[model samples]
Target: MKKITRKKHLEMRLQSIPSHPKPKVGLEQYTTPSVIASDLVWNAFSLGDIEDNVIVDLGCGTGVFAIASALMGANSSVGVDIDEDSIALALSVKDKLNVDNVDFVVSDICDFNQPLDADTVFQNPPFGSQRRAESGQDLKFVKKAISLDPKVLYSFHMASTEEFLIKFYSDNNLEITHIFRYNFPIPKIYDFHSKEKADVDVIVIRAELK
Candidate 1:
């Protein structure tokens, strides 16, 4: 099979991948749109973070980022998620596509300690929009990513929290290298959704350990 070299090709591959069967609102389970995922993965690849590198995607919903990294020439990619259903779907897609460089594990971010020494950490974690109890979920992912001590990290967050995230990263000794803004499209998946589709402002932060 030919490698996925272009962003469009990568997006096409990801477009067919299935999403969670029953998305949980509290977990903020929304599939990352193919266009956004493609842009983020291609940008990381161009930054020398994906090709020939080991990557880990925390809170990986259906393994979009991890699988993309594998397709883009990562030496290996691991996706960890708390949802078993999501992991199962990700594994099925990996098998159907015959992608051998990526693996998916069902584990909560808090309990995940697999001795990972990844070169890059790519994650689209929960933006903490739904449940009030899960407000700081993104911060947990950030702290865990930092614990892995990767050379680079790409994390998605609500654009409104940019200032807070800047301070948070500074306190954690992580430097924000770049921030890419995107209008994330959220389809009405739950009963509480007021619109058929809502565009949310999000920022993908590229950070490095200081």
Candidate 2:
């Protein structure tokens, strides 16, 4: 497979990935936009994290991060999500694209016990802004990623929670490194949403577990 060297091309490729067909309100499942996903994956690739590495995407909705990582030269990309329907769609897309290196699993993040050592992990978990989001759900994802023992972790969070999350990561033994900010677009998928689409400030924290 040819490696996608440029971020622009990677973004273009990722833009074609389909979002969740039936987004669950309780899960707070929103598709990670292609622009942000590509930017983060490109940075990981540039940092010597992607090529020939086993990548994992936690809370993967429709496999954006996993598929993009595979395209960027990951040896294997595993996407884990609790939604079986989303996993089915992701598998269909993966088969359609002939991307043999990516795989999807249906499991709760806490219940996932796969023993494979992951080289890098990407997670765009819930921001805990909605009524259905349990408190510290994002922290749960952080802990699960650490359990995988990845060389590096790229996690998304509400930018407003930066200070608290920094302390949380430190408490969990993750050495702070780079922080990437983006305007995450949230489409009006639910009835509560008033706007057609809105951009929320989000941050992707890059860290290495000690």
TM-score of candidate 2 against the unseen true structure: 0.96
Q: Which regions of candidate 2 deviate over 4 angstroms? A: none
Per-residue CA lDDT of candidate 2, range 73-101, in tens? 88999999999998998998888778999
lDDT of 1 by residue, 1-210 (tens): 578877898999989888688998778899999899999999999999999999999999899999999999999999999998899999999998889999999999888899867999988888865545368788889999988989999999999999999999999999999999999998889988888998889999999999
RMSD of 1: 1.2
Q: After superposition, how far is residue 7 of candidate 2 from its true place, in Å?
A: 1.3
Q: Give each model a TM-score.
A: 0.97, 0.96
